[model samples]
Target: MTDKIRGSIGPDGPPWPVDLLADLHAGVLEPNRAADVRARVGDDPEARAVLAALDAVRTDLGALRDAPAPPMPDHLAARLDAALAEEARRAFGGAPSRPRPPRPAGRR
Candidate 1:
């Protein structure tokens, strides 16, 4: 079958595979990503509309990102921490603590 007939069309060109979409979703979840997406909201009316929709999505995701990350009630954090500690111990044979990589300078 032809590419178009096979539903391979996308706005820019060919369709994106599921894995690519997942990776993109993860990247957009990063801190300050909403601001980055907002910066793309441009001058053209059509682009502005698209940007507006993106802005709505960004807002929802921002809410999710900003939601209370503190320990939940009923000592849930302790339970979770213990469970994760056990898993990490089993998986790595020790407490798992990975260093956060430094953010890039002025790359945002």
Candidate 2:
């Protein structure tokens, strides 16, 4: 269970969204919805195969051991942090900070 979403090809329609199948596979979908998808997969060979393939991939991916995450490059990390801060400020309707004007020498 990585947070990856799995998609499914519907019997006659376009593919269903990833979360629908992922939730069903994870047993998190409401029982009725899970049963509906299960029934559809059971009734249609192509749909069943699609579900199986997605399941297989999920199983394979889950079996992989996680490697230690390396440190982010300082430059990239700084840029990312700055971008996120800017985005948050904008989201909260805050303007960017302005530099203060230089004071005259006579002013203590």
Candidate 3:
């Protein structure tokens, strides 16, 4: 996705993670997470549109429930898992190494 279409953070911090969006769309986010998404969407027009689009897609696919979804092949699933792990590692490289504790007045 281009930067414009890519996730954008609202007034808070980083954008809502894709996983949360997926779960929110899937109606499976934990209660607290669901509340957070709702609040964020309420605060951002772009996010509101994204959720609306997801809802539309879900409504359109509602008929497909007649047949159970096909299972993913083990090999394909493993490859996808590995790719996602790699992407996540790249996104959040080795943990923050520096200490972040607030030091007393003038001690550097």
Report the lDDT tens digits of candidate 1 across residue range 2-60: 33322544423224223323333446544564344334333335445544555688889
> How high is the CA lDDT of each candidate model?
0.48, 0.61, 0.62
Please say which candidate is ahead in lDDT: 2 or 3. Answer: 3
Model 1, residue 12: displacement in angstroms?
7.1
Ranking by TM-score: 3, 2, 1
What TM-score should be assigned to candidate 3? 0.43
Candidate 1 stretches with Cα past 4 Å from truth are 1-50, 63-67, 85-108
Model 1 weakest lDDT span, ten residues long: 11-20
| lDDT value, residue 9 of candidate 2 | 43
Clashing pairs in 2: none
Compared with the true structure, the alpha-carbon lDDT of candidate 3 equals 0.62
What TM-score does prediction 1 earn? 0.29
Alpha carbon lDDT at 41, candidate 1: 30
lDDT by residue (tens digit), candidate 3, 17-84: 44456677777977887877777667656556767888888877886877776666655665666677
Per-model TM-score on C-alpha atoms: 0.29, 0.40, 0.43
Clashing pairs in 3: none
Best by TM-score: 3
